[model samples]
Target: MLAHHTLTGPEDAPVLVLGNALGTTTDLWSDFSLPFRLLRFDHRGHGLSPAIDGPCTIADLAGDVVELLDHLELRQVYYCGVSLGGMVGMWLAAHTDRISRLALVCTTAWVPDKGRLDERIAQLRSSGMESVADTIMSRWFTPLCPPDAVARFRAELLNVDLPTYLACVEAVREMDLRADLVKIDVPTVVIAAAQDHATPTELVRQTADELPDSELYVVGDAAHLAVVEAPRTISVILDDHFGNDLT
Candidate 1:
């Protein structure tokens, strides 16, 4: 089962499942302070989750999420994911009826540059995560982000297992969900970071347009991890997406 943390809310409150980005732990969701029964977990091979054999696909990750919910005896949930996590959410929402609502943050439906991912994997193999932490950090957040938080992220990056990290990287590199986006029927909200170099606003907009029922919101003054950079704004948008009961 996936390693997960759950925060209790009202007894009858709906569960809100959260997924994190690649190379990061469930701690990525720490900034979010919502009233829903918040559930956050590390991807396979990241954080407290056990590592599996390498080269798992995005669908594999999505399946793991489904298993986690099943293990907890939950059949339906409001879901939110960022970056790599967002890709998994797209897969789940398109292929399953478990997700009642979805929020995709700083994510893309298709990988824009496969070459970049190849280079990243090569670097990781040759020099490890420490070699490119700074470069990744630059795109992960804006200059205004607090140094302490950035430091914590760097620590998490370095701590990730090489095989697991590589497997996740490969999954993202090979991920192409453009065609699947049209199949998603659940209500979805796509939140894009205005200055994000990773996914970019246009990619997120394209994802929103492809989905049968979706809305796009571009948040300025933030980069890839808009949830941490603009927690209050994101929380507001999430509350709206999940409805007034979440407030």
Candidate 2:
């Protein structure tokens, strides 16, 4: 099924597809203003998208993007993703030729702690999102993050569809993209947050190192959701990485 999406920016420019992190919608990339034609969408079970009955895998998530691209008649696009979105990006880049350049932000090749994820899932199933909201919020942004920004993301987290969120979490729990790293041959940039406890800087670095051709850039004073906590810094980093030449 095609995920709900919106396309904006100049009609004749290169296309850039923006993927959202877990628990976020297309609105996650609302802060970005770049030269390319931008496409942003909600993942399965995310904002404005339909929920699935059971668990989904990374390939299943990536398949949604493929369906969306095909529906839009887009042959190729620059892909950028965060966290869960980044995991989907890796699969798309490795399994399909639709992606030209790739940017992975605040993501990992695999879920490093499946046991912890299992515990999180169990907690969510029992007490609801409120049970894990505070913990997720802590990893999302640092104490120095703007209060309003933190509040906004926390609300977004609370608003997520529970069943869908749990299914996606299961996908992450079962994910292992380490072997897919070498297959991503396109120009790639891996962005990390210095204070991200979710996917730490070192883990992000390992992802970059494994990619055949990639560069790593770490943003300071931010956590997992750096794009929201440090919007200006992330915007600049993205523009520098994906802007300029598309030939």
Compared with the true structure, all predictions reach lDDT values of: 0.88, 0.90
lDDT score at residue 146, model 1, on the 0-100 scale: 95
How would you encode candidate 2's per-residue C-alpha lDDT over 1-247 as one tens digit per residue? 6789999999999889999999988878777778889999999878888888877889999999999999999999999999999999999999999998999999999877788899999999999998999899889889987788778888888888899999999999999999999999999989999999999999999999999989899999889988887788888877877774555
Report the Cα lDDT for residue 209, model 1. 86
Residue 101, model 1: lDDT of 92
- How do all models score by TM-score? 0.96, 0.97
Put down candidate 1 lDDT per residue, 1-247, tens digits, no spaces. Answer: 5665555567688899898999888788777777788888888778878887758999999999998888889998999999999999999998999998999999988888899899999999999889989999999999999999999999998888889889999999889999998888888999999989988899889889899988899999899988889999999999888975445
> Which window of ten consecutive residues has the lowest lDDT sum in model 1?
1-10
Q: Indicate which candidate wins on lDDT.
A: 2
Screening candidate 1 with a backbone cut-off below 3 angstroms (N, C-alpha, C), the clashing residue pairs are none
lDDT at residue 73 of model 2 (Cα atoms): 96
**Could you tell me the C-alpha RMSD of candidate 1 in Å?**
1.5
Q: What lDDT does candidate 1 reach at residue 118?
A: 94
Each candidate structure's count of clashing pairs: 0, 0
